[model samples]
Target: MDPRPPDETPGPGQQPKPPFDRERFIFKTLAVVIGTQLLIYSLAAGVCGQRALVGRPVGQICPGTLEQLQGGFDSTLKLLLALLGGAALTRMAPPS
Candidate 1:
């Protein structure tokens, strides 16, 4: 005979986790991280180069601003695209 009864339900605070919880968690985390990077890139592009801010002189770019813009446009965009591709691949891949 099996131990205990077969029709038992879990008690409160013991609900079963969803089957794709890990995948959902991964997707949410990546979304937040990539979204933040997009925001940063936008800010850098707005503030840097040929723009006159409150204290900054006209046509003077802030140090490291160009690098931030470059990375945001190049590397960050690539990573964001890759995340989309990865998500699609994950959805299509067979369950292990």
Candidate 2:
């Protein structure tokens, strides 16, 4: 004679939530932050390294074009890894 439908289970028992894991959470967050910083640094390295240095007082060239190319490739790899890391972290996060 109660109005509620039989299909609906009463409150708390129906859903069981996982306990918070602070260590795991902190570790994950730290990893994510490191990944983000790496990504930024990589991209910045590509840009900063690519600049043509015309006149250095020293006769020797500090960085040649090959170094710039290497920087670009390294940066691209770091950026790609960061994105992949973020995806993994997102999956690991708790629903709460």
Candidate 3:
């Protein structure tokens, strides 16, 4: 008789590993990345707009703000394209 609890040990023929889920993992990672990008861009837009809203002189604007905003937009676009590509690949994959 084994001293360990039954549930604590794997029985013969009982593989404890769960099945690998590639599709679900990829989609979830993409969702998190896209959400992060969206948040960055939204904050950048707000900061850029604030300077203009308060009647600040044009020269007072931070030069890096525009660049950062543009970079954020570009990154977000790439992430969206990646998601679309993933979806396309999944569709083209052979049915299990």
lDDT of 2 by residue, 1-96 (tens): 988768644486567557798657766776776576567656655554554343324322434544655675577568657767887898899988
The residue-by-residue lDDT of candidate 3 on 1-96, one tens digit each, is 998766756789988887788877977887787677778767766766786699875463555766776786687678768877988999999999
lDDT of 2: 0.62
Residue pair clashes in candidate 1: none
Per lDDT, the best of the predicted structures is: 3
Candidate 1 lDDT for residue 85: 90
Candidate numbers sorted by lDDT from highest down: 3, 1, 2
**Superposition error at 44 for model 2 (Å):** 1.3
TM-score for each of the candidates? 0.49, 0.40, 0.53
Q: Identify the runs in model 1 with alpha carbons over 4 angstroms from their true place.
A: 1-9, 12-14, 45-60, 90-96
Tell me which of candidates 1 and 2 scores higher on lDDT: 1
- Could you tell me the TM-score of candidate 1? 0.49
Local error of candidate 2 at residue 37 (angstroms)? 0.8
Taking all chains together, the TM-score of candidate 3 against the true structure is 0.53
